[model samples]
Target: MRCAARRCAGRRRRRRARGGRWRRPRRRARAEEGRGLVRGSSTPVRGAVLLYGLLAVGAVTWVLADRGTIDLWRHPEPLWRFPFAAGLAGGLVVGVVFGRIVAWLSRWAVRRTRWGAGLHEEFHALLGPLPDSDILLLAFLSAAAEECFFRGALQPTVGLVAASLMFGGMHLPVNKRFIVWTIEATVLGFALGALFWAGGQLAAPVAAHFTINYENLHFVRRYRPA
Candidate 1:
């Protein structure tokens, strides 16, 4: 959010991460109150909630309807299995790695093309108003719901390529943006799909997805182009 500057500076000076609830500097808090900038609802947050809720519900319904095909956890291997634990651990590693790569890509894109710069601007414009908590919550919600629908429900039915393509397509921006966004998302879909297919479970993909979302959101929020 645009408040990244204030938030970052405040964080530098503040003592904590709102042990119970989020807080800001006394002066900044009063300033925001005066400007009527603090509120409980906004267009971006509401729209994301509705969209992600639908994706989650649809994924659940589809999975339930076609459980014969969609495998949530590895078969024959119990939840306590070592391989399953390893898969989740591996996914988390992959997620952190990918998140960093994408953040680098963001910087490169901004320097290379107008489309990239536009995408970066739009990214900030859309997310700039949100606080850290909402960003994390939405990132988790979107990643889980998306992985459920794409990797969990669809991959089994349509195979990996198709599911990955659909996943990338789902993220196309309404306005112009760098094509690399879709390209990267498609690649990510492929990676996630492969993760699901190999593990024969949802745990790895979900873990990886959440980590990537969390890491990337924080990176982009703070990142500034020179």
Candidate 2:
């Protein structure tokens, strides 16, 4: 009778152990789910701050450098009267080519899949609707600031690749957004860099960037939903 009682006790103990193990998983799962919620909820705000902050910092740095107070040593160049004009022409050519390629890729991709759809939606959300003045201001500021930073100072000393990476890095850390966008921005950065390097004038890339942005803004405003 004692042996049978001990066997019953063993069975009860095993049941209790199994119940405890199962209960643990439930608590762990709840904790994991809560963590996911917190991460997901905070990602967007964090990403925006990161991206916008980088751009703003880069702009401020460029502005300070331009004023000669921050004088980060850059390659000295002989002043040429025609550098501005040359840069303007060369920048336009490069901008047109790059713009066409981007547009074609966007068109080809947008019709085919969910990824394209999401890209389209995101693109529209970020830059689809704006007034003429807003477009002009955005184009001007972006052209002036980006050209000054990437093409003017960084590209001359660091080479095209480093400048490109810096430009891309400055646009970083979007929520679950692939680094591919950063790379793409880098390539665009390089193109502008090349324009400045080849033309030997900051004005060229700035003009080109402004023109490209204006066209892009116009196209999106016309075709995409707000």
Off by over 4 Å in 1: 1-41, 68-82, 111-113
The residue pairs in collision within model 2 are 87-204
For model 1, the run of ten residues with the poorest summed lDDT: 32-41
The window of 10 residues in a row where model 2 has the poorest summed lDDT is 36-45
Off by over 4 Å in 2: 1-116, 177-179
**Per-residue accuracy of model 1 over 29-56 as CA lDDT, tens digit each:** 7654343122454577667778888987
Query: Count of backbone clashes for each model?
Result: 1, 1
Candidate 2 lDDT tens digits, 175-200: 44434556667777877666565556
- Computed on alpha carbons, the lDDT of every model, listed in order, comes to 0.69, 0.61
lDDT of 1 at 21: 43
